[model samples]
Target: MQTESNGKRKRPKKKGSRFMRNAKGFAKQGIFGRGTHIDDDQFSYFINILDAMKAGFEDVEDRVNMANNVFEQTVDKEIHLSSNQIVSKAIESLIGFVDDAQLERFFGKFGDNLRPMCSDRFASHVLQKMLEIAFLRGLGQAAAQEQSEADAPGPAKRAKPDAAQVEEQYNLETDFSDKHREQCRNFVLRISKFMLNNLEDFVWDSCATHIMRSAILCLVGIHVPKIAFEKGGAELAKHRKLYTVPEEWHEVMKEFPQRLELWPQFVDFPYQEHSSALLGVICLSLSVVDKSMLKHFGKKILTQSLLKPNEDNGDDDDEKKESKIEIDDDNDDQGNNEKQDDNEKTEKPNSEPAVLLPKVFHYQCAVILLETLLSVAGAKLLTQLYAMLFSGRVAHLSQQQQTNFAVQRLLQHIKEVSDFESVFTELQPQTEQLLKMGYTGVVSALSGACLRLGAKQAQMIAALQSALHVTGDKEKSKLFFNCLVKLKPHELLAGDQSGFVHLHGSLIAQHILQFNKPIFLVNCILELPAEQLSQIFNTPNGSHIVDAFLQSKYIGEKSRERLIRQLDGFYVDLAITRHGSRVLDQCFKAAQEAQKLHIAKELSNKANMLKGSPFGRLIYTKYRLDTYKLSASQWQASLGQQQQKEESVGQTNKRPAKTATELFKDILTQ
Candidate 1:
C-alpha cells in the first residue's frame, strides 16, 4: 500500500514558471521572476538566499558581492521593476535558511519595503519569507546565543558568584541586547503596527492573509517545515527539516507594543469563511505539538526528524532519508504501469471491487502543510484536534485526493474509542475499496491509530480481513497473512517474493500485533514458516512485528512462550546477527524461566560463534552462558533473584499511587 499504488492516483506536480521563447524577449534571464527595469541588487538577494539555503553561508562574501551586482545594468527610464518578480524569486528560497548578516540587512529594510509588497500577489510571499527569516535569525542571534552567554561562567567567577553579590555588581544595560536583535524586535513591532494599521486590508485581501499566519509562527517560534508535495506516500516521505527557534523568542514577542498586538487580527481571521483551510492547518500544527516538546527536542533535531517526517505511527526507520518521489514524468509513468501490473496479478476474484479515484489536480501544498502539522502535534493535543476535524467526514475526506492525506495523518493521531468509531463508522464500508484503490497508507495509518488508541481491534481486523479477501477464519491462509504483510496482493504464495519490506503493509502487521486481541494475526504470523520468520526476525522493520508481539501487554505470555519455543532450533543463528540478536535478547527478557534455559542452553553450545559477533558477544555475556555451561542448575538458580527483582519492579510501576489521606493515616498508625 505504501510502496505501490493501483488506483489512477493523482499527485501534485511542481507548477513550472511560464516558459518564454529564447529569441522573443531581448533581456537578461533569471529564475522564476522576470520584469522590466529589473533591479539587479534586489533580485540578487534571492540568489544569495538560494545559496544560503543550499550551502549555509559558505562563500558569503563572494555571494553577497556577486548577488548584489547580478541585475546592476541600467534599464529603460519609463518602466518599473515588478514586485511579483521579487516574490517569485523569494518563495523559491526558503526563509528558514538565510544567514544572519543578510537577515540583519533584510530586517532593516523590511518595514520600508513591506507596504508595497504586502498586497501584491507575488510580493506577499516575499513579505512572509522576510518575516520568517528576520525572526528566525534574530531569535538565534539574541535568544539562543546571547542568553547562554549572559549566565555563562567567567574565568574568575567560575569558582564563586553568589546571587546577591552578582546582582549587586555594577551593570549598565542598553535596551534589548545586540544591534541584530534590535533590528529583529523592531521588524516584529513594525509588522505588528502594519497589521493593526490595516485590519480590513489584511482580513479581506487574499494575498495578505498568510503573512498574519507567518507572524504568528514568528511570535510563537513555530516553524512548520516547507511542505514539498510530490509523488508517493509516507514510505517515500523522507526526513524533512522541522521548524525550530529559541525558547526565549516567545518572551520577546510577548513584550511587543500593545496597540500593535496580533491578537485582534488572529481573532478576526476565523470569522472569514475562506480562512478555515489556512487557519485550520496552522492552529492544529501549534496545538498538536506541545510547546514543551518543541523546546526540548526542537533544538536537538530538525523539525521533520523531531515531528517525524514519515508516517504518524513512528515506524522503526523514522530517521531515514527522503522518500523517493517519482519526479521524472517518464519514470513516473513506468512506475504506475508496474504497480498496476502488480495489482492486477494480486487482485482476488472474491475481493470487493475497488472504486476508481478520479485523477485531479491535487491541492498538493494543502496536503503537505496538513501532514506537517500532524507530524508536530503532541499526544496531549489529540483530544482538541479530534473534536475539531473528525466530525462525520472521515470517509468523505479519505475519498478525495487532497483531504485523504489529512485524514491519513489525522487518523494516526486518534486516541479515544469515540474518535476511532467516529472515523471507523464512516470509513469501515469503503475500507476495502480504499485499500484496493491504492490508499494503503490510509489503512496503515488507521491501524496505527487503532493500536495507539486501543480501540476497535476486532472491527479493524474484520475490515482488513474482508479487504484482504480472508473474511472466513478458514480462508485465513499464509497467503492472506502474506497479502496483509506485504500490503500487496498475490495470486499464490511465493517465498521471498515480497520485496523491500512493503512499509505500509509491515506497519499494518506491527500495529495488528500490538492490539489487545491480536491472536488471529499472531496465529497467522506464527504460521509464517521458520524460514520466513527467520527472514522477518533479521529485518530492520520486520523484526519490529516480533517486538510488537513480545512487548504487547495484550499478547498472552503463553503466545510469547510459543514464539520462543518456535525459535528454539534457530536460537544460535538468531543470536549471531544484529536484528536477530536484539530479538533474541528481547525474547530472553520476556521468556519464562524454562524458556530462558532453553535459549541459554542452545547459545552455550555455540560460544565460538556467539563470541565472534559484536551483537552476539553481548548476548553471551548478558545471558551468562558461561555459568550455564558450568552447571544448568546453578545458572537457573542465579536467575531466580533477578527474575524476582524484575517482577517486583514491574509490579511497583503498575501499582497505583497512595492517596494523600491514606498516606497520612498510615504514617500516624506507624
Candidate 2:
C-alpha cells in the first residue's frame, strides 16, 4: 500500500502488495553512529583523507587510499566507522562513489572482520550498504536465482538464494562476469554466516536490528529495494516495504527474541518497540505465500513472543546478556570530528520508570505487531491470544495513546458473536471517554465491529446518539451523519467553501451505511436537505458515502429513487467539481431511465455552468446533455437504445443458467 509519489501519473504498483501476509511495512532507514577515533594513523593517512572526504573532497585515488587506510585501522586498532561520524561518512563515500576493482577490493576486505562491525550503530549501516552493493553489482546472479525459484508456491518458495530479489525485468547479465558475481557472492556468504551466528545479538540490539533485517533480506533472497542502496550511512530513513519472505527466514527466526524474556526490559529500554516492529516486518515479509511457514511463524514466533504466561509466577523468564560492542572510550570528538555531527549518542543509562504500566503503554511498536498478529494468527492461536491479550483489555487499551492502535486492530478482528459481546460489553461504557479523548479510530472500529458481527446494533445506535448528544429530530435526521462525519451543523445547513472532508467522520459514516440493516442510516442520509446532500456529493470521501447509499443492497428501489429525486435540483451542484462530478456520473449509472432523463434535463438547464469545470465538461460529454439541448425526444430515444444494448451485452456475457430438467438429470445421474 506504500506508493511512490506518482504525481498524477499512473504509478507502477509494486506487485508485492498483492500477496497475502502480515509484514505490511518496511524499515524506515539505516541505523547510524559515528566511527570510533583512530590512533592518528590508517592512522595518519586515513585521518587526513577521511577528513578531506567528510569536508567534501572528491578524488578516486584519495578514496582508494581512504578505503585501504580505514580497513587497516579497522583490522589493526579495532577502530570502526560506526563510532566516528567522519569515518562512517567517508567510508560510505568510498563504498558508494568509488567504483571498479578498488570498490570490490574495498568491500572484500570486510568479510572476515564484518562480525564485529555488525554490532555497532553506524557501522551496521556499512554492512547493510555493502550487501545492497553486492546484490546490485551481482544483478545477474540475483536475477537467475529468482527465475529458478519462481515456481515455488509453498514454504520452499521462500528459500530462494540470498539477495535473489531484483526488479523483475532488469537485464543485468553483462554487468559483471559470472566469476566476479560468484566472488562477490562468496563475500556475501561469509558476512551472512557471521550475522547469522550473532542473530541473537542483532535481534535485541536497537542499533543492530536494521542490519539484521537487511541480512534477512539477503539470506531470504528478498530484494533490498534499489532505493535502499541510494541511502548512505548517515541518512537513517525508512525505505520501501519488505514485500515477501522466503522459507529460509524460518531458520533465521528460530531464535526470534522471546516475549517471556522481555517483560522486565519494558521498563528499561522501551525494548518492545524495536522488537515488535521487527516482528511486524518479518510477519509481512513472509507475506503468507508460504502457508506452512505462516503457520509455523504464527505459532512459533508471534504466538510465543506475545502470549502471556500460563502460571501465576510470570517473572521466571531469564534475561539474555546484552551483546553490545564498546565504542572508543575517548569522548573528545575534537578537531574535524565536530563537523561529523554525532547521529547516535553513546549508550548511557536511563533511570527506569517507577511503574512498568506507564512504560508498556508507550509501546507503539507492539501496536503494529499486534495488527500483523491479528491478521495472521491461526484459529487456535487467535483463541489463545483473545483470552490472554485481548479478552478484558479492550476498554483499558482504548484509553492509552499507544495501545489504542492495537485496540483498533483488536476491534477490527472481532468475528465471533461471543467475542463481539465481550468486547462490546467492555467497550460501550467507554464511548463517551473515547469520543472525549478523540479516539475516533477506536470509535470507528467499534461501530464497524458491532455491525459487522451482527451484535448490539441497537446499542451502537444508542451509544452514538448519547455520545453526540442527539436530542432532537433534526439531529437524528439531518445532522446525524454530518456530526458523524464531523461537519459543523452550521456548515451542513449553510456552506462548505473548501471540500476537505474529515476522514474519520467519513469512515464512521461509511461503516454505518455499508453494514447490516442500514435502512435507518439510508433514511438519515436521505433526510438531509438538498444543500447538505449536494455538499456531501461535492467531496471525494463524501461522494463515497452517497455512492454507498445508492449502491447498498439493503436500500430499496423506493429509497434509491427518493435519493435521486432529492438531488434533482443539485445535479449541477454535483457536476462542478472532480469529486462531485463522479457522484453525478454514478447518479446516471445507478438511476432508472426516467431518473437519468430528469438528471440530463437538469444539467441541460445549467449547460454553461455544467461546462465550466473540466470535470463538469467531462460529465456533459458523458451523460449526453448536449443531445438533450439538440432534441429531448432524440436524447430519450438514444438513452433507451443504449440501455437496451447494455442489457443485451450483459446478458450475452453471462454463463447460461442450467434448466430445472438439466439440474434434475445431473442430480439423478450423480
Candidate 3:
C-alpha cells in the first residue's frame, strides 16, 4: 500500500455468478457448476450483488442463460400440467400453503436469501414457486383473520344494541358472509367479485376436490346463515360439500310445509338478497315440483316472504301498486272486452312476508322458475303453483311485455340451447302446462318464437296442424289464424316463396270453409274479401282461398255441397266489388243462356196453341201455318227484336244472367 499498489486489483468471481468470463466458456462446453464459486472475491461479490439487486446486465451471459431456462421451464410445465387432475392437485397444494401457518412462514423467510445462492435460472424458478405459495397462503390467512375479527367481542359495548346494530349483526351472521360482506351487503356484488377474480382462472386451472369444494362451499356458505343453521354452519359448510344431497334435505323433505315457514327468514338474508330470493322462489317452486314438498310452513313462508311489506328506501311496492292499478283500470275500460278480464284480481295481503325484492327482477325470475317447474315438476304440483301465481289474478304487466317475454324465452331456449327442444314436443311437460296457462295469445307466442328460432316451414305447419286437430277452443283457433295473417311474409316469414305462413293460411282458410263457420268465413272474406282474394290469385303463383279450397283434400263432398249452398248469401256482397261483380255476371249469364237454348225448341209448340183459343185462334192457326212460310229475313228481324226487349228488361232489373257451369261450381262449394 505504501508503494502505491503497482499491480491492478484482481476482482474475484462470486459463487454461482453467471457473468464470470469462464461462465460463457462453461456454458459453451455444457459444464454445469453446482455450489461452485470462482476464487476471485471481487468478481464474485459483484455478481452476487447484481443478482441480489434483481437488476439485469447486458454483459451478463450466465444471467441470460438463467432467464432462458426459466422461460422454457414455465412454458413446459404449463403444457404438461394442463389436465384437471393436475390443476386440482396444484390448487389443493396452493390452498394447503395458505391454510398451513408453518409452511407460509418457511416460504416467506427463505425465499429472498435462496435466490442468489443458486444459479440465476434455477433461482428464478424457485422464487416464482415460492411467491405462488405465499399468495395462496396469504389469501386463506386473510379469510381466517376476517372470520376471527367477526367473532371478536367489542370493548365496553352496550349490553343491548340499537335496532340498527342488531340488524347489522343479524345481517353479518346470515347474509354478509362473502369476503367483502362488510363493504357491500349485496350478493350480486360478491358474486361479481368472485366471478371476476377467480372464475376464469379456476375454470381452466388444475384444482383438487377439496379446493373445488372449498370454492363452491364459499358460494353455498353465503346462503346457509340466512338459512338459520347453527352458528358454525358456515364454517362447517366450508368443509362440507354438495357431493350428495344433504341429510337435512331428506329429513325436511317430508316436512316441507314446516321448512317453508322458517325458510323465509333465512331466504332473504342480508348477504344473499337477490340470489337467495331467487332460491327461495325455487324452494317454494319445489311444491310445484313435488306437491309433497308443499308443507303448511312452506306455503306460509312463501306467502309471507314473497308478499312482505317493503319499508326499505329503494322499495318498488308503490310503483308496482300504481302499475297494477293502471293495468287493471285499462283492462276494465277497453272495448275489446277480452276473455281474460273477467278473472278475479288477487291481492297479496299486507300481513304477507315482505318481498324485499325489486319487482321487475322478481317477475323475470318468477317466469323462469315457473317455466322450469312446468318442465320438470309433477302435474298436480304444477297445477297448484300455477293457481297460486296466477291467483294474484292481477295480470299487472302489459300485453306486449308478456308476449315479448314469452317469445324471447322460447327463442332463447330453442336457438341457444339444445336441451330446450323438449319444450317443443307434445310429450314434454311444458306443453301441457302451456295449455293450462290459457294465455289469450298463446298461439301468437308459439308462432313468433318459431319464426325467430328459424323453425322449418314443414315443421311449423305440422305443429299448427297438430294443435288445430287436438284443440277444442274456438277462440284459440281464431287467434292462431289471426296471428298467421299478421305475420305472413313479414317480420319473421322470410324466403322468396316457401314459408310456413303461406301454407298455414291456406290450410286455415280451407278449415273455415269446411267447418261451415259462416261468421269466420265471412270475416275472412271481409278482411281479405273476395276482391282481395282475386288480387292474390293475380299475383304469380299466388293461389287464393278459392284455389286452396278447390285443391283441399280435407274438404269432403258433403262439406263442399254445404259451402256451395251458402255461397248465395255471399253473392250480394260479392257483386259490389269488380271481381265479385264479374264472377256473378258470368255465372248468371251462363245459366240463363243454357236455359234459353234448351227451352227454345219447346216454346214453338206452346205458341201454336195461343192462336186457337178464341176468334183469333183461327187467325193464329193461319199465322202458325204461315210461320213456316215466313221469309228468313222477317224471322231473323223478329228474333232480334225479342232478344233486344229481353236484354233491356234484364238491365232494368240489375240482374246478370247465370251460367250452368257457375251454378255447378256453387253447388260443389255448398
Candidate 2 residue-wise lDDT, 241-359, digit = tens: 22222344445544333332344542322236666666655654444334455556655543444553323222422111011111222345542252232222223225221112322
Q: By TM-score, how accurate is candidate 2? A: 0.61
Over 4 Å off in model 3, which ranges? Answer: 1-265, 269-290, 294-301, 309-363, 373-395, 398-670
Q: Which ten residues in a row have the lowest lDDT in candidate 1?
A: 165-174
lDDT of 1: 0.55
Report the Cα lDDT for residue 66, model 3.
Answer: 44
- Model 1 lDDT tens row, 1-670: 3344542245555332222222113225544354423455555554454434335333334533443333232122101332535424434243333334544544544455676667776556656656654554454422321212223456533555432122112111112246765576567656755764675567567767667655655565444322211222332222111234544544433332222223544332222433433444344333323445332322222222222222332333322211211221257677687557447745764532222111110334434544544555455445444554445446756765556777787786555577678888878888877866677778888888788777877888888877767654575554566777666544433444643456677888888887888888888877767766776677666767787888888888788888888888787888888778878878888888778888888898889988999878988887788989999999898888778988898777552555333332222111
Q: Give the winner by lDDT.
A: 2
TM-score of every candidate: 0.54, 0.61, 0.26
By TM-score rank, best first, the candidates go 2, 1, 3
Candidates in order have lDDT scores of: 0.55, 0.57, 0.33
